[model samples]
Target chain A: MPDYLAGIDIGSTMTKVVIMDNGIISSVMGPTGPEQRRLANKVMEEALRRVNLSFKEITYLVATGYGRINVPFADKQITEITCHAKGAAHFFAEARTIIDIGGQDSKAIKIQDGRPIDFVMNDKCAAGTGRYLEVTADALGIPIEKMGPTALGAKNPAQISNICTVFAEQEVVARLAEGVPLDDLVAGILESLASRISRMVNRLKVEKELVITGGGAKNVGLVTALSEKLGCTARVPPEPLLTGAVGAALLGKDMVGKALKQGLPLEKKERSLREISLY
Target chain B: MAEEQKKEERKKRKTATEAASKIGGMVKAAIGGTVRAKEEGKKLAYSFIVCSYDEIIRAMDIVPVWTENYAGICGAKRDAQRFLERAESLGFSRSLCTYALCGLGFDQWREELGEMPPDAPWGGQARPDMMLSSGQILCDPRNKWYQAAQQFMPDVPIYDVGLPWPMYEDDIEVSEIQDYYIAYIVAELRGLVKFLEEQTGRNMDYDRLSDLVDLGEKTWNLIWETYELRRSVPTPMGTGDAMNTMVPMVFMLGTQEGYDFFAELNRELKEKIAKGEGVVPDEKYRLLWGGGLPSWFALTDFNYFNSKGAVFPVETTYRMIEPTYRLNIPDTDDPIERLAWRWLGYWTYWFDKAKKRPGSEPDVERLIQYIEDYQIDGVVMHEAFSCRTWHLGLIWQLNQLKKIYKPIPVLVLGAGDKKSLEHRELPSLILESDIVDISSYSEVDTRARIDAFIETLESTKKSKADQQ
Candidate 1:
């Protein structure tokens, strides 16, 4: 029998789920929706099915991300900032700065001794987030998945003034009318968005071993831009988007052990690989 | 060529006719004024005075003059710095909103308008038998400003009209607001009229009151048009111009001339809107700005944001509270309670009802709805030095919005006065500054940092797409 653990990230746009058994990643990715409770159930069901584990067998289930509050099954909820730091620390133990650009917001967190010392988060506007890229892609009639490489291919990127997603759309439309190259426009968008991220990280006093995570980390163009802008090498974790969820699951396991040590009663089920409590 | 000249002549004639009509209305208001009443030839029955709203000023048989109009007589603009110093010496810190202190300092100087520079037109001598203040509480506590009035004029009656907070939407809050505002306005109006009767030795006139309400309604309609013009993308006026445009309302809130000027301005704005021409062209981004007044020391940061294709569609807390002025009118004899409620009811002024029980969540929801309705691209939350309310709940709202609208980006920037920028430990605050501290980062270094952030966002966008 093996021990089982689960991690869930309830993002603004999507939810991600991961299952790990004795330190080996067993399953990744799950469909999530706007409603938190519904998405939590869906992700949990999927993770349980993939591992062939029943709900009673799961030793710990942890939740993180914007919708962490709505996860009823999770034994504990940690701030996304804290979770990201822990997850990044696990991957790159010496990482000093963690820059996580998610669907709706961008955060630059300062890490010291595996603890999140300070952080800056953008939540009020949509200009520099994933939505900006999605809207720009939609307006360009390009699938969002193709934007980064296409942008990288362009030699001359047009200058886009507005970083605001809505206003940027109008500018993109106008530029298209003016016959600007799509590659250039995409590069310009990337360049403009990078400036906002730089501001967030710069506030924390940029340090070495910068690790980038979240859904946005997968873009090579942005990585190149950030590296160039910061004048320092940056690293992205494997399965960058799952970092927060992984941290959440790990934290949950720690919480369960601590609770048991403190003489708190555990759920009546035995700790086994086949019958885990998905919650 | 002769037909063209004739057409031009006809247009000039039409303009002249309109101007004459406007002048005639002013003349009528100037003549239909009332004298203040007195006891024992000088008992000073009214304790403090506030200028009336255009509607109330017209409703009363008195003239309405905004405090800004007395600046020249008080030499406020020229001596504004001096006056501010005096206020600071008296314990008003520079951190207090400059606008409120300036208004108060100017009012104090107006008390001695007769001794002003000869070039001063009005001499600050138009002593009001009564005064009224609208419920705009963006800066200092309105009640404190009211309290300060006694130092300038020991005996004039001061009345405040209650302005509700989170304007333009009817909710459960309005009934309490209406009751509070109505009581103050009615009491103040009655007190003002009673004083006038004692001085002039004549009873109040019902007919006169009816005439004033009609004038007030017209003025309000004119101001509404001014606000409507701003809805146009790129706006019909620049930020500087918008500040200036507020002058007519502040000075002549209760006058026919004020109404006519705004009406004409509205007409001009409508023409521009119809032509599809922005007041300021080449707008790239429509942004929603949240924060109190920007640091005066760092005013250029706002322009920096704007120059980057970001146009501020709505300012949080300050101007959003302005529209509450329309809710209650002084229809009763008791105007004091109405005056108090109108000024005190502003959301940010006193106990923010939004933060109790149901708390600020609903307010956040409304703000989000407003952003969506306005089609705003992003939110730029300026976490200022001392504003705790906005700074505290910002993260929660950002996370919530991110969960629902994952596409929009929320940027949080921290800024403060000159002193805060000097501290090395305040990296969170310093990094947020657009113009980095010179000692900490060179000009080149700052530019590099800003450029880097922009690159990060671009790269993030790129990487996400590649994965998909």
Candidate 2:
């Protein structure tokens, strides 16, 4: 039987699963909900169904991201930081730096020879993450997806000086009250967020080719602003949101391969793809 | 729901080491002793730790109420919230040093109530006859904390002693300024002695002070030796226990108890090393707690690292004792002069070596030396939100250290292979929180960061092994 491996990433705002059999078989992404365990199971079940397989067919599994421990059936858990580095490296072999701005946190990881050498994360704040843009977008009555495109169309981007997300939202409203263009407001928001993330990324001595991953990377305007700030054009994977999950799956395969090479028993759960019963 | 369940399933943290466990009783007695000092006719004085005046106070038979240690006890016991709230209400910003705020808040409450605050940790910090405000070069709060406390108790006098050292300069030898700095410190000590004599209505005892100073030097040397044992692989003790052991070294410095405790601790670590015992059963990665004061309330964070197969063999916090014999001080019978010399020596101990090291300052040099000596795989630090004195330089130090290369001997292969050396950069992690502010802490976030750091360490280890 061909060996199968799976990776699940339960981020603060999104849940993703990627299934692999030597190469990628299927991948799924969805918004995370309060019921993390159910969401994890449901996401995994969907990804498995897409590949016509059940949990038992997986040779090994790994979970990553903020809510990784919530996936009760995962064979092992790794951090999203490591998963992102590996996944970015997989997509871009020469990738040396990764800037991942997720739902609630942003991090810059420095890579050497496809391995994470160092990283720095923003302090406990939401000013430099996807949450910042989401809050600003809601305040401006613009969809999070539209903010990026709207930002790219700006004739004159307003200078946003507020470092706090709440204050930045207030600033956006104040600018709108003064009849500032919506595109300019959106551009200003992305610029401020990019600057914050760039400052953190610079701490690692950022080198090219920098790959921007995570849901935040899906924002073209923010990615461009960050690349300009970093003085290096950044690359975004085909599916930025799926990189962490893909990396986790690849690491799971590596673990299984190592276990077999050493003739060591692999630790895994007698599994199910169904949601765990509360009772 | 499953995350909460996993958190619940986590094993209870292990207890402190044997020597460390004894700190609780010692601390209780020391605090209780201050409360009873008036009844026993011993004058009680408020003092800060590491101010280098413990011997003088002891010789004068003045009982010291260690305000910072009391604040730390309040933090450890989770009883600091009430005091913190009181201070915040009194116009103290929450962003100020929490230790100072906690101490100030306790003093304000006590002065108002004319008694101890409700449920004060360890019978409350006793009211002092006088306050010694440390006007040190670092810790601006130290110079202000006692003076601010004096607002409530106007009758009590305050003594501000400046404990400045020759600030680090690569070109200037410490010997050039040692005489001037020592003279200034000696004058400060003499002024403190005069102030104490006036308060107690007794003349200064030079002979007794000399003996106490000698004892303090002995205790300092003993502490340096005791902590040196932690350099052993799979260290028998770690920073977690050192936090406990630091109480005696910092607070009880001129006393026999302090020296004896370290003597016992030294013996304990030696025995553990003999049997090849370590802090954890399987020590995977040895880490250095590179900088910053720890979150006193959440010391279990250390245990959390231990559970992940990481052990902190050494930390650049609280372990303040350095070898005193390294400095050349003109032999002086005057205890005050010797005390001043010792103080200057301790601050400048790493200057010469730091100057020789490329891209290194004193703090960074100490970190590099400890990493090499302890065989550290990575560096971990806590950045207390309020204490910028220690937290500010950490980022720059790590950045500078990364820029400098440390040659690691590697064995090459396939071309008449021989062992060659390669320069490599060390990995580091910075945890953010406050020394006593539990509100700023998040166990989930901290653990996630730790997990990520461990992964990075694992990857680096694998890369190194592959290269070899």
Candidate 3:
């Protein structure tokens, strides 16, 4: 009989779902494919199954991120920018600035006491997004997940001058042909990406205590270089990618509380999660 | 029956754009005016939008065709891709301004085929007798778009006139260099006149040119006053409509039709205000589009905003007749000197004010003024990726505004039992897209940003009311 809330963030690269019920929070993450409805259902099913809950028991559902509109059962849709700020605020009570580098876009959200006051995003170019790092890592023959720790051991990092991901990959190949150390090249790529992010973050008049969320925050090398360039120690979420889903859950919980106060339930449809196949 | 039909029509939605578009249609229909002039044994000159050379061109009895205008027509019609690909095929990078790319491509294709491309937009831009180019600071494409294009029409001559202005800065006294700048511009104008006179085989008419300059100055005042009327509560017109109406302001300035068009527009706006009509019914939020040229392909987004109860009372982009009346003209009888001074006036209007006010930028100052006058709830800007002239200073301007201005007064908690006060900054949103490249734009992302901004504005509004 507990009131539950569901927050689903269907991003360009990943689909994440967070379920909150009886003061317990759990999440499931998976790759997003062309079939957004299937991805949304699969993640939601996994998250709910972990919590031993039914879709009917969820009081409110909020969707966010670029592919948010594809979530058919979402009661309300909010932007990832606002959700990221709320999600960061959940961890750091005084977190004023959020640097969220996602699959294709990065956002710098300014939070004032848990509410997003302003946000700046780099959606026009792929230079500073996770895509930049992904392509560069492919050229370096390094696993995307292991790029951080491997990059940390560089004695002298090669300087990457190109911000364009394609040109940066070309530079990586050229460096490899020149017999440049892989660790140094990776370190240079991370450093260059971090400096690019630092410039975008500074535009929002970044204030401390800053929190870095999204998949890119997992890279320890990037986190370290960002700290050095931004002049602040950055805080990373335990599951950086789930921050958006977590934020959506928080907003969804708030919507549930409001709907309960007004004695008006939100609009949502009951559907069989089993019907959706990842294929 | 007639009255009932009229009432039904009144209830139906109609755009104020028709009035401005009428003038634009006439102008576009005159596109092949250069070709017609050739048939009539008349001379034609190709020029850029910012040249302001129409007065001299008209005085010299030369037909003037704007390359930028032609480029814009192709953009609005969504016919630019063909010309863009042609330019790219000719080794011109797509990173260049689409306006320039489209023109260069069309010129090359026309010269190759010896005629207009199959079903070109606006019957294709007319080939020119001579090209008139300008060197304005900020737009590198304006300086280079024609030079690269001239390779196709090797016989046609180009008169490149330098009309550069000092880039905006904080410490430099613009007046210290104003005299030299004006003198240089005057000399350049004279040099242009010499070129035109040589091409047309006619003597320069100073009296007629002076009359044209006087007319342009009058139109400048009228356009400024006409847009100023939008500051009224429930503004009568929106910036999307202004984008259409500004054709005369861009092309027909220094002419009687342009002055009349604005005069009639001002009167219409005053009547709409008297009747208490707004750009949209239920105008919930008044937004100020502060800077950057709009994405031509996605102009319908204005209607989208309108559907969301957002009314754009003013935009700082195309309607840039901010402060023309306040310029200090030098003591000279020469119309070209006055033209030089007027050009400086438009650019330095806010700089002079910023000089008087500590910690102010021309662009940011204009933003603040428009925000207050228009009763704006939020500021939004489009950052076109290709052009740095309009896009580069945007982030700096936003940061400067946040640094200096605290417009929102909200209640706050103090150390003691008594409540203290705090001031918050207005929210600024920057939406990034290319001016002509449809590929760069994502409607879902843009709308999400807009929705988030509206939510932020809603919160800011609720808190502002809470203080009472």
Candidate 4:
């Protein structure tokens, strides 16, 4: 039987889990509010039930993301920077730069020689990340998932000038009052969000073969705007949000192999990454 | 009498001219030596020194230093750019503080060269042997840079004096801080003295120590005077230049040389004021700066106000809280408490003693007292990223200040590292506004957003006066 590995990412807004069997991602799932560690186990259990797998089947478990330290069952924790780089490299192979925009923060990671050599993170505020989009969506009374397509319909997008999400919402409302077209306002919001992410990437010199991931990667409008701003195309994975968890699981597998080769006991218990869910 | 007055004016002008000339000459000489040393295939160590006050590092015997002084230097500017590039190449993320990258770049440059020149400020090497820091600023880059320095120079010692974060004035926290402050001072002083003794094969004499302490006291007095002058109408110093004034004093602290310089400055500033020559000509509103130093990229916003006759009287938590630590004297048996008291007074590491009461917090009270004593008109709060401690009670403090002192306009600017400034509209709006309606507070997001708010304030004041 092939050994299975698990990866879990506990984000501020969402929690993601990816299970890999023999180096192939078998399944992935995400739930909101996995931020609390105690609650993560329950969510992970539900995810496992959906995939018809038990925690005992997994040989190794690795945790990544902001809440990595909070995950009690993980064998080891790797920085999101390293995990994102490894995951991006796995998918794109030639990707030298990885831009991950999660719910609360955004990060720009530069990869060299298949390793994350440098990374910059913006966790201090909710300006440029998915939070900004959420706020704008709430102001427009539009579902966030529909923003990308709606924004694409914009012809003459109005500009968003605020960096703070709270402030940007007010600005969006004010613009709406000024009778700006809904599509134009949406386009402006996307452009502004892209500009913020680009600044982080630009600091790293925005090297070629960029890979964009995280929940924000689902926004096609953001991808297009960021690509145009960066003057380079960014490759988006099929399930970008699961990349961190997938990378963590892969790392866990590597760790298990190294430990077994050194004649050491697996020591850590097998815990299901799917036990954690947002809802 | 007229001739005597004219002669005195000439002498003052000459002194001012001489001071400017001396600074220029030092720059020229340092650049010349740097160029010559570079050509000689000599390597130099690039050291980054981060502290709220410059005195401790200035007192150290190291030489060939590049500080904020090189920001405008001819080739120095290019050197900083190249240094930044090399730092990015070294896998340091650009999202980090520019100052850290600059320091790393300088270090890389020295590595590219072979050995340092004999007269290189850092003992004939371009690489720093030590990184001296204080916890006053609470900038993550300072801590991270020190760690990076440790990685590069595994053998070099990195010494840091913890400046209290959450500096709330209270008996318990203050007493505990006094202990930490005194212990840190004595420990750092003893370590440095011992190092110097080993290096020079002579112990630091009591006379020299006393003299150094006395000089520090004198510099402190001058700094107080400078702050006082900033309060005067048509304030005697512009905020742009005021920020730089602390640089020389900090870098030169704990030395007779620094003492002499400050003494000269004190004399010059006194005479200038006596003659009614204001530091900031046509000063209007006098604002207080709360939190870390304004970003270098935003120094223009500060200058713009100075040019428009607005004065930033007392800036930086260090200038406000450091003098309180003087009570932590060397002669006392309870030096540790004294040190702790000093540490407790620090802006970053201050622990609030009165957490139960929202408005009646003792730390908040003490801060209010400091602001009141300074007689500030308004407060400019920079809510910087990664500096969570500073931002926690800022809104509360603003509210308290308004309740006590009749609604002074509080402008809060949200700022982050270099990349954070890309969203500049929010800060610009705040700066331009007179009364920041909390509802409108988040509109301007960029670092430059404060400028807009300041402009709005000026316009509103003008309009109000026009109505009057």
Best by lDDT: 2
Please give me the total number of clashing residue pairs in predicted model 1: 81
Regions of model 2 farther than 4 Å from truth: A274-279, B1-16, B39-41, B405-419
Q: lDDT score of model 2? A: 0.86
Cα deviation of B25, candidate 1, in Å: 21
lDDT for each residue of candidate 3 in B302-376, tens digit (9 for 90 to 100): 877887788888998877454455888766778888888887777777887677667777877888888778888
Lowest lDDT sum, 10 consecutive residues, model 2 chain B, at: B405-414
lDDT of 2 by residue, A74-107 (tens): 8888998899998999999999999998998999
True contacts kept of each: 0.04, 0.73, 0.58, 0.00
In model 3, the clashing pairs are none
lDDT of 3 at B163: 82
lDDT (Cα, 0-100) at A86 in candidate 2: 89
Residue B395, candidate 3: Cα error in Å is: 2.4
Kindly list the per-residue Cα lDDT of model 2 for residues B430-459, writing each as its tens digit: 999888888988888888889899998888
Give the winner by TM-score: 2 or 4: 2
Q: List residue ranges in candidate 1 displaced over 4 A.
A: A1-279, B1-54, B58-80, B91-97, B100-140, B152-185, B192-212, B218-240, B294-303, B316-366, B380-468
Candidate 4 Cα deviation (angstroms), residue B18: 9.1
Put down candidate 4 lDDT per residue, A1-279, tens digits, no spaces. Answer: 778888878777777877788655455455556345447666567657767888777777777776665466677766676677778888888999899999988888777544564455565578888989888999999999999999899999899998888889999999999999999999999999998888867756678898899989999989999999999998998799988887778777767887889898775844444434323
TM-score of chain A of 1: 0.89
